[model samples]
Target: MRQQQPAPQAATGTTAGLANAGSKKARPSVWKEYVKTRYLFLLLAPVLIWYAIFAYGPIYGIQLAFKQYQIMDGISGSPWVGFDNFKYLFEASPDFWKVLSNTLRLSLYHIVFGFPAPIILALLFNEIRFNAFKRITQTLTYLPHFLSWVVLSGILFIILSPSTGVVNFLMQKVGIEPIYFLGNGHYFRFTLVVSSIWKEVGWGTIIYLAALASIDPQQYEAAIMDGASRWKQTLHITLPGLLPAIAIMFILRIGGILDAGFDQVLNLYTPGVYSVADIIDTYVYRMGLTQMQFSLTTAVGLFKNVIAFALVLMTNFFVKRAGQEGLL
Candidate 1:
C-alpha cells in the first residue's frame, strides 16, 4: 500500500504545532526593561511633563483660531467663525501683509548673511594652531549669547545713539554723518540682522566645530603627504565632510523662516522703526495682547506654523534629490 496515511487527528495536531512554533516569537520582558533603564526614565520624566503641560496641552486651544474667542466664554464655548479670521488676515488687513513681507525679508537676509558666518568661523578655528588663542577668541564671541536681549538692547541703544555715542563719535572724527542706526527703517533692519549674527554666530560655530571634530584626522595627514595645499584640503575634504551638517542646519533654519527672533526684535525695535522692524511675532504681540484681537493673532500664528511645516518638508525633499542626505 502507499505509505500509511497519518491519522486525521495526528495530522491536525502536527499542523497546529508547526503553526504555533512559526507564529510565536520570544518577547523581551517589559519589567526587565523597566528595571534596567528605570533611572534614565526618571531623568526624562520632567522633560516629558513640561512638554505635555506647556507645549502639547496648549494645542487644544488651537481651535481658538477658528472661533471668536471670548474671555467670559472659554475656547469650547466660543462661537466658531470658521475662515473669517484667515480672510481678515489675507484679504482685509493691510498691516498683516506688511508684517509678513518684513518677516520674510529679514529671514531671507538672515539665511544669506548669518548662515555662512558660523561655518566660516568654524573653518578658521579649525585652521588655528594656537589652541589658547582659539579658545579665548571663541569664549569672547560666545559671551554675547549669554546676555539677555533686554540688556543687549540697552547697550545697542547707547552704541547706536545719534549723539553722545561711541559710534557717532568715531563717525564724526572720520567726517561721516552720525547715522541714526536704530531710528531709520533701513538702518534698523541692518542693525537687526548684524546684531542677530553677533549674538548667535558663536553658538552656531560651536555646533559646526563639534561636527568638524568627528571628521577623520587621517584624511588631513594623507592630504599633507600628497602635498595638497590647505585650501585644496579644505575644498576636497573639510567642506565635503561638513556638507551633511550644513544641509541639516540649513533645513532647520528654513523651517523657522517666520520666527525671525521675537525677543531680539521686540527689545531693540522702536515705534520709529516699526515699518521695517516689525515682524510677524511682534505684530502678533501687538494685535493679540495690545489690541485684544486674540482669534486673529491665533489664526496668523497657525498660518505661519503651517507654512513653516510645509517649507521644512519641501526643503528636505529638495535636499535629498540633490544627492545628499536630508534632515529627515
Candidate 2:
C-alpha cells in the first residue's frame, strides 16, 4: 500500500522574499554620504578632473604603437600597421643591442653600489654623537640633490677636464697620466654610475633615515643590556627593522629597471660615449622626435612599460611569498 504524503509546511521565506527583505532594510546610502560631505567632494573635484584629463587620459594614445601615426592624421585616423613597429625595432634598428645592454648594465651597477650607500650613510648618521656636526654633514650632502643634472654635469666636466681640471692636477701630483674620462667609452659608464650615486645618495638616505627613526629604542636598549656593542646592536636590531622598507623600495627599483635616469644620461653623454651611455628613453626621443619614427618609438615605450609591469608583479609575488610587506 502507498503511504499518504505529509502536508507541506507554511513557507517562512522564499528567495524573492529574502531578497526583497534585504532591499528594504534601512542601510546607509553612498549618495547620502556624498551629499552630506558635498563641500569636501567639491574640493576634490578639480584634482580628480585634472588627473582624468592629463594623467589617465593620455593612456588612450598607446594605440599609436600599432599604427602609422602622423600629426595631420592624428591618433584615431592613423593607419594601423599591426606588429611592424615592434619588428623594426628588434630586426632593423642598429643600436638596439648596444643601447639595451648599456641601460641594463648601468641599472645593475646602480643597484649594486648606489642602493647600499644611502643605507650606510643613514646608519652612520644615526650613530653620530654630536647633533651640530650631524646636521652640517646632512645639509652639505643634501645640497647636491637640489642641483639640476645640467649644472651638475657642467661641474663634473670642469672637474674632470684632462688638461686643467682639479682631478687631473691631483693625478699629476701622483705622477700618473691624466685619464680622458669623458672621451673613453670604458670609463664613461663608470663615471655616469658614480656621479649618479654622488648626486642622489643623500636624497636616498632620507627614506632610510625615516625608516631608522621608526625602529624602537627599546630593542637597541635590550641589545645593549646584553653587552652587545653599538655595531652589533645596529646589525641585529636596526638593520632587521629596516628590512621591510628596503624590500618595498627594492621592489619599486626593480619595476623601473629600464628607466636608468634619462635626464642624467642626456646631460652627461655625447657621441663618444653613446655606445655605453645611450638608453631606451634617449633612443626613443631621437627616433620618434628627431627621425620621425613615431610608431616604432611608441612600440619600444610600450615594451618597456610591459616589462616594468611584469617585474613589479613578479617582485611583489616573491615579497609576499617571503612573508614581507610588498609594494602593492
Candidate 3:
C-alpha cells in the first residue's frame, strides 16, 4: 500500500501552493479599491492640485533667504550670500531689537488677557437659559470677526477721535480729559489688545461652546444632586472638561507669539505710536517689500518661522508632559 506513495516534500509543496492561491483570490488590489472610490477621488483632485501649486510650489523660493536676489538675475541666477542677511538683522539693524521686543510683549499681553476672554464669554453664554437673547449676543460678538481691520480701524478713529469721538464725549461728561487712545504710545498697545479681544472673542467662544456641549449632562445632574452650586460645578467639572480644548488652543497661540496681529497693527498704528505698536511682521513688511531689502526680509521671515516652529514644539511637549492633549 505504501509503494509508489508521493514524496513528503511533494505533498507539502502542493498544500502550500493551494493555500497561496486561496490568499491571492481573497486579497483585493489597492488599485481596484481606489477605482471603486473614484467619485471621492475626483472630488478631492482639485484640492490636492491647489495645494501642490500654491503651497508646496513656493518652497523652492525659500532659497532666496541665502541669496542676493536680483530682479534681472532671478532666483536661480542670484548669487548666494549665505548668512549675511541674518547676521545683519541681529547685529546691524537697530530697529530689530525694538521690533522684536514689541512683538514679544504684545504677544504676552494677548496671551494673558485675550486667551481667557473667549473661555469666560463661552461660560457666560452657557449660563444664559434664554435662547433668543443668547443667540443675539453671540451673533453680535461674532460679527466683528468678519470685519476687515481697515474698516474697524476707521470705526475706532471715529469712536476715539479727540474732538468728535463718542468716547471722548463720554469722558468729558465724566470730567476726565480727552485721551488719544490710538495716537498715544502708552495707550496704543492696550487699544490693540482690547480691540483684538473684542473682535475675536465671539468666534473663539464658538469652539469652547462646542466643547462644553459635548460634556455629559449626567455629570452636571449628579453634581447638582450632591448639593454643588453653579460656581462649584463650573470650577470642578466644566473647567476640567475644557482642559483638552484649552491645551490645543494654547499650543497654537504659543506658535503665534511673534506675529502680534500685523493687519490690525498696520491699520491702527501711527508714527506717534510706532514704539508701542511696531512688531516683527510690520517691520518685515517695511524692510522687505517696501524697502526692497529682499534678502534681509527673507532672512527675517526665516528666523521668525524657525522660532515659531521651536515654540510650537516646546509648548506641545510641555502640554503633553502635563497630561493634556496637544495640537500635534
Q: Write the per-residue lDDT of candidate 2 for residues 1-328, one digit (tens) a residue.
A: 9997654442434656777878877665889888999999899999999999998998998999999998898999999999988888899889887788888998999999888899899999999989999999999889899999989989989999999899989999999999878878999888888998898888898999999999989988888789999879988898988899889988999999999999998988888888788899899889988999888888999999999999999999998899899977
Question: Residue-wise lDDT of candidate 1 within 1-328, one digit each (tens)?
Answer: 6798789999999999988877664555788889899999999999999999999998998998999999999888999999999998999998988899999999999999999999999999999999999999999999999999999999999988999889999999999999999888869889999999999999899888988999999999999999999999999999999999999999999999999999999998888998898899999999999899999999998999999999999999999998779978
| Candidate number with the higher lDDT (1 or 3) | 3
C-alpha TM-score for every candidate: 0.91, 0.88, 0.91
Q: Which stretches of candidate 2 lie over 4 Å from their true place?
A: 1-50
Which residue pairs collide in model 2, if any? none
**Winner of 1 and 2 under lDDT:** 1
- Candidate 1: count of backbone clashes, pairs at least 3 residues apart or interchain: 0
The global Cα lDDT (0 to 1) of model 3 is 0.94
Q: Give the TM-score of candidate 2.
A: 0.88
State the displacement of the C-alpha of residue 217, model 1, in Å, after optimal TM-score superposition: 0.8
lDDT (Cα, tens digit) per residue for candidate 3, span 39-101: 999999999999999988988888989999999999999999899888888999999999999
List the lowest-lDDT window of 10 residues for candidate 3: 1-10
